[model samples]
Target: MIACDNLTKRFGHFTAVDHVSFAVAKGSIFGFLGPNGSGKSTVIRMLCGLLSPSDGHARIAGFDVAREPAAIKPLIGYMSQKFSLYDELTAHENLNFYGRLYGLRGAALRRRYDELVGLTHLAPYLNRRAALLSGGWRQRLAMACSLIHQPSVLFLDEPTAGIDPVARRELWDLLFEFSSQGMTLFVTTHYMDEAERCSQVGYIHLSKLVVCGEPDDLKQLPVVNPPDTRRIDVTCEHVTVGLQAVRQLPGVRTATVFGQSMHLLVEASLSEDFIRTELARVNIPHADIRPIAPSLEDVFVALTNNRNGET
Candidate 1:
């Protein structure tokens, strides 16, 4: 339901977003992933009509961002990083105000208010002031406020930041629930676990999207020598020496030290006997060897680090 063409944004001599282009399918949750200062927020703002692009163009729900911002504004809901709600207003009051802003009134406004309260699990707190709510409650309140008008598209910028893991999971469940009901979500998050939950993810770095695909597809991107395919944990007197010795062994791709132990990534065909023989040659006491699936964090780190080196 969203599309961008060579989108660019600049302030003075620095470009915040550089010729980035991507599309979000209707009813899909598209995760925008990046480190600090990677322009995820800038792009989001531009798409939401809160900011104008310096170059290129974009459309939301088939309306041009620049030429038809007003028509699109009411069709999308935006929840910024900051909690944007009146602290003194009760949960019901806050939604009431937002509903009015969208031209909802009387029974319509009351119905939406009650529906949002129920969806966000804030029914019990309907009479509680926003400021009195805890972080998780405030977050849910903010989300409810954003959806008060039942917009077709939702823009969430780090909505789960600073919340506990359990709260984060609950919030994600809510997002998936909304998505299942046909609401398109455009979210920006630093957490890899959340990124993995998205239907598709765009990995941004240095104002550019380095990769965009499903989480598993991104993970399967070609790695050097298939990532050595094995991990060996060893505890030795000299971890550094053991690492260096492992690096020299055949089939060993990389050896990294983790605390007092070293993790070796070696070819799958290499047997424990061969690894033990290599350790014996270096007089490094060995501990154990096992296989583990590579995580999303591992793939992300590898891609970003490799990109940094290239630059």
Candidate 2:
């Protein structure tokens, strides 16, 4: 339902989105990921007809991004990172305004408003002003407004940014509901766990698409494990301090704190006894240290490092 054929975009002398290409199947939730300024948003704009690509093009719901930019707008929905839904208006009023802007009138507008309210479960907050609603409620309101036109394809750029964890999960539930109904969802997020929920994921780096595939396939990539190296998850007290201590040890290629645990990409020859000995020497209290599966974050870290020649 969505395709990018060598999509390229430029601004003045700077190339924003390089010749990136990927396809999204119908009813699938595709995750777009990258560091800041990696052209994730640039590619979204080009696909949504908000920006013109300097070279190549994209298609949404079978409409050419370059030739039929206008035609594509009506076929897709876009909810930007900072949603511009009116703050002074109530949730219902905001949807009503957007519904009208999308050319729904009278009976059609009312029907869509009801459908969106039911779909997003915004009925309880319908009369509440957007500014008065909580972060989660506001996000749902923005999502409803974006879908006021009932577009088949939805583009969400950092939709869960700055929201609480519970709110993020709630929003993802809605995304899953949309995908189950045959609506194509393209979402960009920095949260690794959120990317895991996507059926397909595309990783962008330095304005180029470095890798694109299913989460399991990405996790199993040889680039992640490399040669003579393995990954281990170590849960230790004082996680921040433990990270500092563990990173200074030999054979530890990469050490990062994840929640209450620490992930280390270390030399496989480093024995568990050796790690325990080293941590104990520094008085860093640890619960358990064991080899573990590579997570999505590990895959991206390895892929990005390899792509940038970081070894």
Measured by TM-score, the strongest candidate is: 2
Candidate 1 lDDT, 1-311, residue by residue in tens: 99999999999999999999999998999999888999999999999887899999999988999889889989999999987899989988898888999999999988888788778888889899999999999999999999989999999999999998988999999999999999999999999789989998998889998778788887677762264475556666677877787788888766767678666667788887787778778886564666655555556666777788788
Identify the candidate with maximal lDDT.
2
Candidate 2: where are CA atoms >4 Å away?
Answer: 285-287
Evaluate all candidate structures by whole-model CA lDDT and list the values in order: 0.85, 0.89
Worst 10 residues of 1 by lDDT: 223-232
Give per-residue CA lDDT, model 2, range 261-304, as digits (tens). 99999998988887877777778745598889899999988888
Candidate 1: give the clashing pairs.
Answer: none
Against the true structure, what is each candidate's TM-score?
A: 0.85, 0.94
Lowest summed lDDT across 10 adjacent residues in model 2 is found at 278-287
